[model samples]
Target: ECISSVSLSSLIAEEFDDFPDAELILKPISDGGDGFLDVCRFHFSGKILNYQISTPYDNSELICPVLYNIDSKTIYIESADLLGLKVVSAEFRNPLKLSSKGLGELLLKIENDVSSGKININKIIVGIGGTATIDMGIGACSALGLKLFDVNDKEILAIPENFNKVEDIEWDNKTFPFRIDLIIDVDNPLLGRTGAATVFGQQKGASESDIVILENGFNNIRNFLQNKDITDSSNPTFGAGGGIPSLLYLLLNAKIRRAKDFILNDLGIGRLKGKVDFVITGEGAFDHQSLMGKGAGIILQEFEKRSSKIFLLCGIIRNEVNKKLPDNIFPIEINSFFQNKDESILNIESGIRLACIKIKNNL
Candidate 1:
């Protein structure tokens, strides 16, 4: 659950070697993020819906979940399926044209279901962390109903290679039974230096030229919205889904929320208010950026409120970051004692086992 496949697979192999004949039932765990989709499968009471959808790079199909939170009157959409880059190929991993239509299709499915059941929906919290393309928000709109036309009044088929070409949008959105809350994990703005195109483009294989194209396209989308007669949604969740949240804001007028809030409210974490003793967490890396809206920072903050003992593990712990750890917590860098020059997997496993051993000893 808290372990990556690389680390998990290797860990299993090591356990088998040590025991030689142990019969073990292995289970995976997630730390309240994308992993929750699989871990909480048994608890979900709604119908499981799957659909054929497009990727950010090329058109394809992805399967996803349509979670209905009855108590809160919300529909929870897990984005790990369609738009997550972990599933898309490198050549097909274009964030510039990534659309949340797969997500849209899921929500629309839920909407029809809930509507038929006559269940009132107050919110639609779309968890957008790992995604493939970055088409602002037009892809989802086009997939839904709105027509994104170019100069000739013909609909724009693929990702917007350039922004100046967008002519107009005709939205015939059916009256949604409820509002939408696009829960984005990152804080990058819609465009510019610290925005989506620049901050996340490189990881998704967008070059300097691609970033420029995406930025200019986003700008054009912005201009189109400003001139529209309807309400302006430029200031919405423009940071999520490579600014897809903001795109939804302008195109579909969705309410925005932090991913943290979605988890907090959904989990009712306050129930753990005076019951915890120690908290342990780990991640791929730790740095100054981890302090800003990252899962690590958020976990530490929540634990701090309870004055819980926190044990944190990471693949690498930079000197500057170690200086910021609070006294009650143990922050360990797996690299100090072990270094495998040839095998990164071995290095990661040694790190995890070492960190777990330290925590086990401490407890």
Candidate 2:
């Protein structure tokens, strides 16, 4: 029911189309999830290479875009394109049967291209967010040459359903050809109350019983990897993308970076040399989590230092988060302008324009 950042920015721009003697800069930010590729395309002049990758639910494939910055020799990948929850149908959202195999396939394709001299690359930056599976990336590892076997030494598939059947894990010793940087949106450990399984499993359509299965599966695999000294579940960033980063960290030695840093610094949001006057940022909902490394919180922190007059607009704002706002930042909740929640979402375009109009009048 929420408007996209791009659409919101346009609405704001149209409202301030004739403002007297002022410049308007539109910067649409993403948490490296659904709109990651679009945001990358917006910021950088690069080639978009599309490849058919497997879907989250089955073996079928879809074309996903990969951004390549020629000058920096960096390749940006949005994990959600191949294995995001939004791509899967509501009925097929079960993590128990899903696999992250598509992600591995894409990575292998990129590696093959590099090895064949088709493209030049020094770093592969993956935005890991909004994934559907919680198999601890066993499925992806399988595609990348990680093998699993049962107690009888018989090999088995590396899916969540086969986790309990797995007795041994074998790595093909395949190393990534380039530096791997994983960008995570949330800071959650792989195992605990706020871990991947407990915190995000339900939203992916996992039931209470299914969550138990997933948590147990993750624990089993974690212990196996621990014996080999490949990975530790204590790292909070490992929880992003249903534990995909954990296995990547173990196998590819991927470095974990917060979305705030990657999106702001590497993507040029934090690299603006000139003085910025005003900044307007918002999210679908502003809550405690928004303050914890989310885009809006990071934007607030970044612009607060510049003494810019900031306006934080959101569909809904929690009272606790509102109280904690800085003195320079003004909070605008769209819901307050509507008769009810339904009306606000249905007429979100009007709500955004009204919010911007209010901001202009205040100035």
Which predicted model would earn the best TM-score? 2
- Stretches of candidate 2 exceeding 4 Å from the true structure: 272-274
Clashes of each: 10, 0
TM-score, cand. 1 vs. native: 0.80
List model 1 lDDT by residue over 1-363, tens digit each: 235533453464454455433343322322323544543343344544455555555556666655665665665565665677767777666565556566566657667767798556777666666666677766676667866679988877646574557888677754467787666666677877778787888877788888888888778777777777544434534756666777577656677776556444544443554566666655557888676666666667777668557777766767788887888778876656555423444666666666656765675
Score each candidate by Cα lDDT: 0.63, 0.84
| Cα deviation of 267, candidate 2, in Å | 2.6
TM-score, model 2 to reference? 0.94
Candidate 1 wrongly placed segments (more than 4 Å): 1-33, 39-47, 68-74, 115-123, 229-236, 335-338, 341-353
